[model samples]
Target chain A: MADTTWLTLAPAFLLGLTGLLVLYVDSIGRSTKGPIAVLSLLGSLAVAGVAIALPDALGLGPAGWSFVSFTLLGMFALALFVQPGSQNRRLIAGLSTAGAVGALGVAAAFLFTFDGEPVNPFGDALVVDGMSLLFAVIVASVTAMVTVASYNYIAEHSYQAEYYALVLLAGTGMTLMASANSLVTVFVALELASLPSYALVAFLKENKGSVEAGLKYFLVGALSSAVFAYGVSLVYGATGSLQLTAVQNAITGEFTGMLGMGVVMVVGGIAFKTASVPFHFWAPEAYEGAPAPISAFLSSASKAAGFVIAFRVFTEAFLQVSESAGEFLVLGADWVLVFQILAVVTMTLGNLAAVTQDKVKRMLAYSSVGHAGYVLMSLAALSGGGATATAKIEAGQFVLAGGMMHLFVYGFMNTGAFLFIALAEYWDVGRTFEDFTGLGRQAPVASVAMTVFMFSLAGLPPFGGFLSKYLLFGATVNSGFVWLAAVAIVNSAVSLYYYSKLVKALWFDERPDDKKPLEISSRPVGLYAAVIFAAVVTTAMYGVFGPVSDAAIEAAAALL
Target chain B: MAVDTSYYLILSAAVFCTGLFGILTRRNALLFLMSVELMLNAANINLVAFSQYYGNLTGQVFALFTMALAAAEVAVGIGIILVLYRNFEDVDVAEAATMRW
Candidate 1:
């Protein structure tokens, strides 16, 4: 009921501050981890600050419980972090995990506290709204999961502080990306998210795959950003302003060529980030080569950020461009037609490519691409672009909300799937689909979690993925994009075949003779914790689907 | 009178094209990095030119941000390239082709 606008920034602030603190401590010495964790304990409680700051907030129920549990979690962290020995791996991991989880808690808290009104605390540079808060929760949740999984995944690696710091930093950038209201902020926030990602992908400096993938990812990323900057210039040239609302106000069909080209180029740049087809070549290689936890971070949290920018730019910045286009919106049409084409191609190509992959990571990478297509359709479904009618616009928000909910679901299931990979990698389980044979018998609990992930990703019933995809497609259809929905449904069917392949290998196939056994690394507690946490949330999504759906609707409606 | 905005755009376009060609043809990582810089600077020229033409400081300010982005990109780019050379024993991007591109 209160303003809670500045409280919206708590998550970004906590993660970013923790990132700097971790790096500075790592520079000083190894024993600093315990202190870092204890210090961040205060930062974590910044979430409870929502309860403490707002009147009658303690009566809100969850706030009081969250505060109590947060304190307990800090105590638990203290017990683990202060353990003896230099290069205290637990300490750094604990610090990062604590920081990320704190960010997640704050984001979740803000979701309830935000009054659903758009607040531009920083002029047109940034807007903190329900949509941004929702994205912050997604990013922070994924970051928390990644940091938790990285506890084990990164032990053998050095630069522990740098890795965690970059993860947190990139997350800060990503949350900012969702809030960016102008072209300049969007570009800057994008680069902020991307630069660290390039580094994180190459974090395994000695590994040839990591370094090579890093190079490829960096080259592609640099080129796309250059393209994005050019598009911004063209748009500025035409409209004389970079602010989203101002751009919409300035739309008058003058410099249509510049506007059109800039819009397409900007979309192209976003495609690169989302790893949609044409710019998706790097995604498979990067996911395959990078540390699996980092892969999950990029695929889940970072990709959501990419879609957030695309949604904001088109719907908010170019809202007027569509209505101003004259005649049927997509008949002979505008960039909306281009989005329709992209939505179909990206989904189909992603699913088809996913089928041919033997490596589990690479397969998931392609599937990651497929999911992007589904979300892109939300933007494609945007109130039929040029319709001045209020009902048409509301229908547009429905589909957009569907996409947001899908991303929320994705933030869980996809991250869970990739964390399973990290668990496998940590256990030295072999890489191919064939290697996954008989893992079911090896780690039944984790395997079941993974089965949930696979089935969920394939959009099977009784899982979160099914409901989210259903909502997305249904909204698209209801919005009068029947053909688009048809293509997506077929693509969805094709996707099932590949997603099930891993499930088949997990439970059905027999281990090859003389294969290194899964029991070698008995249990990675961090991995199990992260994977199971994701699995629980993803499965619980079904039960809580109503609230999430309504929240997403509210968020999208606010944007429109 | 100064050069026209159209001419500045033309020059930037030429520069951007050259950079794209370089990145495409030259396998050397350093050359590739240089090419990316060229493309970013091309965006810079456009921003500055449009700033004067549109009579707004936003474009001019944005041009500076582009420069900063380019610098940060180059920093990361060169670091990755350095790693590439170390592992592959060559700076050639194509040399590290263990995976299918």
Candidate 2:
């Protein structure tokens, strides 16, 4: 077999091993999930390292698929953080392994495309390209981190194993979505991610709040999927093709009217995923009701998948509008305006609503939506003056790079915030903003870590969020969306009030007389994983920004 | 003498509109689910109509696949609603507001 073939199979191979181990260990009554988690994490790390080490000498030409499995591979390493304490130990292990395995499977799917013939016109449903690879890594890593965080987070829960498994499956679905090349593939992959999440959201199945959250999520999620599928059918109706490249080729100037409608429908479907304004009704309830670690995964991994798919569709497929003189395919000006409006509304609503929230989890949910708006600025940048001049296109690339880099940064800060909430819950500390009062005095390490996370989220200097915001807004300004950038700046300032409130509650507030140390059965390897992610994200702000920037630039180049 | 594609399109539109209305208005979780199924079937009608008109089997195959998936969805949706009903006596979604904003 070719080296690439093994590379493609690597994810599946690792996942298969983990699944077998999980089953075997469960049968033997050896419920020590730590070893299984360790095994899967190591497998994931090895696969990523091997994929990255594979020489660039073997290039799959333009018609050929690009090979990069590092994203899913890297996710394996990150999932080591979410280990449960002792109760339902078997379940947590299984879930951790599943998350790792899912990452592996996704990597395999991408790798399978590398040497394969171009299935563009013939229903190659997923294109394994640099862009997909980058996104795959980001989502996978986040999945890994969430899983690792969960082990410690869900230590006392009874259904740890099933929870981990669902998380893994969701990761698999997201990976598939990131690489999806056709409309049908996109729908299936998206559902694969979403269905497991429906279960995960209600993991506390006995709790009424959990059940209600799950139902609301299911109803809204189903509606959104229908909307998305309908949009796909419309594109098929107008263009007579489901393959993205073909759709792009078929939607000419005469077809613009129908294509625009189709685009709106498709965007509406995806916006639900990203929790953008108008389609964002489900986010807060779902996030608040879900177990904290799951919330982290949903917010970070799920939202990133939305943006990746949006980038693939809008930049590569829908934006292939006909230029005058019939030479170039420039993005339409209307898309820029649509995206700008979405950014403003999503950000303003997310931040404004968050300001009034008392529950920590719900506030974070709103914050995530606000960040989604910030990410949209890059998409707006991609469409320059309704024209496809080379300069304008290059500027779009820069904006996209900035947007993508921010996603990478935000994942850490966002996940860390949820992890702290989970920890607070574990310690029997309060989960409301008021409950966090004097946390800096009680739990110094957690409080400090949480403060770092808040500052990062608020886009303060010396943190990853700051760099991401600068890059995103700077790119927008450069793309001639100075006013959009200005609005973003204002939104950032508005976001400060809520984030600072959390900070003040944590550090400056007086401690109550009854404050006590959070009790736990045992500390597992999960915190190590979170610390690694937090460290990387924090240091990345001050160090190694260049590599991430270069990677984003390269990925964006693939789009242009 | 041409077969009427527009007539089929109109039927699809009508069915889809009905499903959409049900989804928007129905407070009962079960009814909302059935409405989603109707909308999916309406999509299938459009697909089959187009496949016949274009002389392509792809859309027909897609419709078949979609129908199978719809069956799976129905099974899962019902199972979930059963759980909901068990937990809360009535299946009214409005009353299932323990997790609401």
Candidate 3:
């Protein structure tokens, strides 16, 4: 049993080792980008092979191992195809991809194998469960896609090594956050993910926009984290424990204003991570100014991490508070209602703001915020349990599963949309709507892929996004929050206007007379491959919703 | 007179509010970082106070971890601030607004 536990951590260790090896090779100055990339890719492939052959090593169930191995395979492909000729760019991408794969493998192993009961590894400070694993898959996949897209996007930038390393390190932090079983673990992991990301957002130091974005992101991030830590401290004061289960046990039958304040602050801090309003001020600027690939990483992976941790902590620790005390009942209800209101406001504000943005990236940033609202709707539904305990649990599971499905679908569609933007940047197209004029005529393949992504993002039918959104809203209605679902439907309608604007620009606008056909840029293969894969999956996900939703339900059942 | 845990909690709360106020009002990047540090330290104070009152080591240990994380945050925060200084010729947060809505 002990050996199995140690083996569960092997993937993360291997990833760390690979990162060190990459750094060592870079420092030695004897290897070029090509050799480093090749070595990292091989290393990742070896890890994937080990994960498959020794599934019991991590004790992750078969499903967990499959996801882990798939993530690694994806990372390997990302490294293999990103920036075909550039040694430096490929090396950075390879290292980051390897790290993400390693983390994903660990998460999957632990998540899949977890018996719906929390596995308290390392003195119960970290947990391996369904929710964590689901998030692990989401975050790791996002990192892989972003790295694949970054191959061409950051090809011209210097300090390629730092960029990739930071990206991987940030991913590691996020994976850690997903499994954090204690408030202390959550704080450390959140910082670990966020600190690196702050640097990544400002990676293009030469660009004024990038620098400004980084500073604002850092300041806001630092403030929110500090507030979160204070909340942790307050919770510790109230419960005398940082371990979540222990805190939950301690707080039972007790009610204090201090505890209520702690819960509020903690939720507030998580809101910043999700970029939900009124805490969402930094997202648009950060997404707009950062490199397109990093924006994708932040919006998709980082946001998913936020939601996962929020789900873990709130449901695990705070959800049952309403049952224990009369005085605290209002506090518990407030928490639920807060999510309900946040769902409406976040989606509405995001869609409304997105409609007005001229810059495509900015519009997408607002749209991402709106998606955060939709995902929050699931949490709101979870809180609005039915009469009986069994009924409540069933509703909670459905809501969580629905939310997870949406996140999974969002990962593919959102990343694909951002990659399309990266392709535009590669061709020197501006980021505004006008810059995309007549793209369909110039680049038929890319335009088609972009249209699919946009449609999926807008929650159009026959796409994964539509199915996931349907599940989410359906769960909300089942939980008796019909109004929230209605709000979501209205928000979806508003979102279509902006998403279709991009489509209109792509097909309807006239191409400039002097403009040439949109030729594939120097590193077109990796970008095209990643975009096409995401597009295909967005459409194909409709068929696989059953199994995926089942997995999500099972995972949610474990958490409950 | 022995100082009670509540006293420490109150102190931490006061310090936290001050830090939050500074973050909201201060426009200088360096000062903003300092305000964040103040807030983190306030959390540390609460952790230590609660550790003693609870007769447990977990809160203390978490406090130590918080300290280490705060240091790391400061290190990165300073690096970014230095870069901001170099690029914008000033560390004023207000001057760094290049990509507003």
RMSD of each: 6.7, 7.1, 6.2
What tens digits encode model 2's per-residue C-alpha lDDT throughout A1-560? 22343333334234333433343233233354456556764565565455455534347321122223334433543443434333447464655646474764575355334433222321366666656666676777677777777777776676454466567657767766777878777877788788778878877766677777777888887777776766666666667777777777777566565557667878888898888977898899888888878888889889988898988887777665333433335432366678878988899899999999998888999999999999988886676633456666678789989988888788778988887777776666776777788767766766777888888899998888888898898888888888889989998998888999999988897756676543444444675457456646665666656766776787787776
lDDT of 3 by residue, A1-560 (tens): 21244344444444444544444334334443456555665665676677667767656754456456546644544443323122445665777666666666666666556666655555587877677777777788788777777777787776665567677768777877888888988988899889989999888888888888888899889999998999998888888888887887787546477788898889888998999976898999899888888898899989998988888888777765333232122232267777888889999999999999999999999999999999998878775667766676778788988888999899889999998888888888787788788778778888899999999998999798999999998998888889889999999999999999999999997756556545544548767877888899898996767866777899887777
TM-score of each: 0.89, 0.84, 0.88
How far is A63's C-alpha from truth in model 2 (Å)?
A: 18
- The stretch of ten residues in a row with the least summed lDDT in candidate 1 chain A is A324-333
Best by TM-score: 1
Q: Point out the higher-scoring one by DockQ: 1 or 2.
A: 1
Model 1 chain B: worst 10 consecutive residues (lDDT sum): B92-101
Q: What is the CAPRI rating of model 2's predicted complex?
A: medium
Q: Sort all candidates by lDDT, best to worst.
A: 1, 3, 2
Query: Of models 1 and 2, which has the larger TM-score?
Result: 1
Model 2: how far is B56 from its true place, Å?
2.8
* DockQ for each numbered candidate: 0.80, 0.51, 0.77
Task: Answer with 1 or 3, whichever has the higher lDDT.
Answer: 1
- Off-target runs (Cα >4 Å) in candidate 2 are A1-123, A253-257, A321-333, A385-388, A512-532
CA displacement after TM-score superposition, residue A206 of candidate 1 (Å)? 1.2
lDDT of 1 at B77: 90
Question: Model 1 Cα displacement at A103 (Å)?
Answer: 1.5
